[model samples]
Target: MEKDTYKTLAAPGEETLFKEKNSKFFGYAYPVNSEDEVKAVLEELRKQHNQARHWCYAWQLGTEHIQYRANDDGEPNNSAGMPIYGQIQSFDVTNVLVVVVRYFGGVKLGVGGLISAYRTSAQMALEASEIIEKTIDVHFTLQFGYQNMNKVMRVIKEKNLDIVSQKMEMDCEIVVATRKNNAPTVLEALQNLYEIEVKTS
Candidate 1:
């Protein structure tokens, strides 16, 4: 069976801080849906931490069809961004952005040290977030006449579907949403009704 649920952050996580060899790493996590949102958050953080030496970050955008990106931001390749991304994967969260801003403290940590610091900072950020599971939903449009309202409503109620919208004129139209796993059953029930047209939307 295909999985129909995903975990994500409810809101921006509280800022996290980690220090190693006098270098400061500031970590932040935010719920985001698009690359644009990710970019905007990075822009805001750069402004907020103008004196920071590096802004390494990672983001995962989708649930089923996953999309992700990691930026080293001048750190050694795979030292900053990939470690942060690994933390995201370990936490099993999507639609989330993790950023670790570094303040150089007159010391240069080697690749291994940098990786450990970035990974720990990212993990702390995720731990501070409120993770929640959400169902992947499928939408369907049901079209019928007023005469078939009762039949349509019965199926919706029986299946515990959510009514996204409805127009109850003589020609009735309803938009309903159900969990992706239950969509086939809901579609079949609606299609079984006479004179009712159902289409996935």
Candidate 2:
């Protein structure tokens, strides 16, 4: 069966802190839907942590066809970004951005240490977040005459479909939404009605 639900952060997670050999890693998790949002959040963090040595980050977007990016931001290649991204995958979340800002403490943490620290920081940030599951909805546009309005309303009421928009006139039109799993059933039900036009939007 195809999956129709996804997990995502409900809001910005609480800031987190991790330390290794006197080096500081400040972690943050934010809900993001696009690259623009990711860039905006990174810009804000850079301003907030102006003195930080490095700002490494990772973000995952989309639900089914997933897209993601990992940036070391001057940290050793694959040491910072991939580890942080690993935490995001372990948590099974999308549409989220995790960032780790570091302040050098005069001691160099080798690549292995850096990976562990970044992974821990990302995990901590996600742990502090409120994760929520949401259904993937499919929208359909419905067109019918006034005489068929009652039939359409009955199906909508019976199926508990959400009405995104509706226009009532000589020719009525409505935009309805239903969970992806139930879309076929809902579409069939509406199409069965006489003279009612149901098209996936």
lDDT of each: 0.96, 0.95
At residue 115, what lDDT does model 1 achieve?
A: 98
For each candidate in turn, the TM-score is 0.91, 0.91
Q: Count the backbone clashes (under 3 Å) in each candidate.
A: 0, 0
Tens-digit lDDT track for model 1 on 30-119?
999999999999999999999999999999998878999999999999999999999999999999999999999988899999999999
lDDT of 2 by residue, 1-201 (tens): 699999999999999999999999999999999999999999999999999999999999998789999999999899999999999999999999999999998999999999999999999999999999988889999998898888999999999999999999899999999999999999999989999888897
Q: Considering summed lDDT, which 10 consecutive residues are worst modelled in model 1? A: 183-192
Error in Å for residue 30 of model 2? 1.5
Compared with the true structure, the alpha-carbon lDDT of candidate 1 equals: 0.96
The residue ranges of model 2 lying beyond 4 angstroms of the native Cα positions read 167-172
